[model samples]
Target: MADRNTPNRPRQRIIERGIELLLALCGSISLLTTLGILGVLVWDSVAFFQDVSILDFLTDTQWTPLFADKHFGILPLLSGTFLTTLIALLVALPLGLLIACYLSEYVRPAVRNVLKPLLELLAAIPTIVYGYFALTFVTPLLQHLIPGLAGFNALSPGLVMGFMLLPLVSSLSEDAMQAVPSGLREGAAALGATRMQTAWRVIIPAAFSGVMVSVILAISRAIGETMIVAVAAGQQPRLTLNPLVPVETITTYIVQVSQGDVAQGSLEYNTIFAVGLSLFLLAFGLNTVGYFLNRRYREHYD
Candidate 1:
């Protein structure tokens, strides 16, 4: 209460205010950036919809915007996006859950420290490198087994994207499992539950909310991935579920149109923004689901 008598008290208050202002600005940056992106997408999408009806955009089966006979139906792109994401989930989920269980329950702390980082390094590899690896290596390996697999198909990229997302799922799930109280484990042991049974029945159910959130976020990430799909998943936008055939996703379409060949103000140019908005909405929905799941079912322990 007598700090006003201190010579440096006023200076300390000013410094504290300055630090608070700086931290607020840093936190606001993400919010501002997200608003900026949404604004741009809505602005450009308005123009695109002026020329192309919303009904056609939703109902059109083909997406041949660059061709002489132009079409803007987004179904093909959506199908392709769905197919690749499905493949990636199928590949990542079980393997990631197994890896998480092993790391959280079985591995020694020292070994987990070493192994987790090594596993996470897969995520650090540039996505373009994964793209090229899928195109050059995985595709070739698959061709030897599948009789009529296209040179550029969804399977290879989907598989590579799965590997890339493995670390994210496993890491998040392992952290959630680790957060469960040690007393739970001890109680299970006292009840004569085997280690495997305890981990499966007790720990997993307790951490289910976190694990579910991680899976949702991973699905969003797989949907939004770009380069690997761009390189290995072909540019042909076809409404097909055959992973052996070439197809293009919403993200692949955005990359294709953003390559500077399309004029900046043309309908083709505006299509990118429209599709960008769709992708944004998809991701936002997935994130919303994850957030709600985290909030609603999250366990509280003192």
Candidate 2:
């Protein structure tokens, strides 16, 4: 017995050490990937700024870098990006919260088990498929109701992008609501509050930080979305608040320029990195806000 136990202890220790090393390696890979992306964006953007001033890039309204007369204004793209993101959030936020509240606070365990996967299936579809569906089906449907709608515009793609991110928001928010203590619900019930009342007053308030995180993540995803905007929305960047007209987002512009015929090291090529840097910064700022919000408002369960 002593010989057998001694041998097994050494083998188990070796296996545990190997598992720890594998986990550490996986963690380091993510950190290294993030660092690599930041390094490339900053390096290329620095080179771009040597020729085109940062002020013009931020202030200029035009984005035609490939034409004989190059205009490197980035505001048009930013405007389109904001317009579409705002449109998407308007469609998503209410729907996502409603779905989350229902799933977390109302549904029976068996029913929830059956329904959650079906709802999440929306996320499994390829994004390019959503782009085509918006372009072919949704846009045509919208045009029928509003005859002035353009063939390529912000509305259809924004709507599709909103639905695409719905599952993510719902799932995260549901988890947060469900994490709230059952004791809170019981106390609300003792005060004669109904389930609906308890959910809105106690559960949602307790989970507000988590709900905000889900919303911020959804916003970031909408801003960075490429294919849906590229295929459905036109490549023309216009600084307009109207969603019916053709517009281009930063992600779409990046895709467009990447596919175009342009020489390497030219201003046209350099603009890609500059736009990428701006996009990175935008997403970073949003996520940073989310982090602080979560930290500031998070409730301790114990």
Best candidate according to TM-score: 1
RMSD of every candidate to native, in Å, equals 1.8, 2.2
lDDT of 2 by residue, 101-160 (tens): 999989998999988899999999999999999999999999999989999999999999
Give me the candidate number with maximum lDDT. 1
Task: Give the clashing pairs for model 1.
Answer: none
Give lDDT tens digits, candidate 1, residues 29-103.
999999999999999999999999999999999899999999999999999999999999998999998999999
Q: Each candidate: what lDDT?
A: 0.94, 0.92
RMSD of 1: 1.8
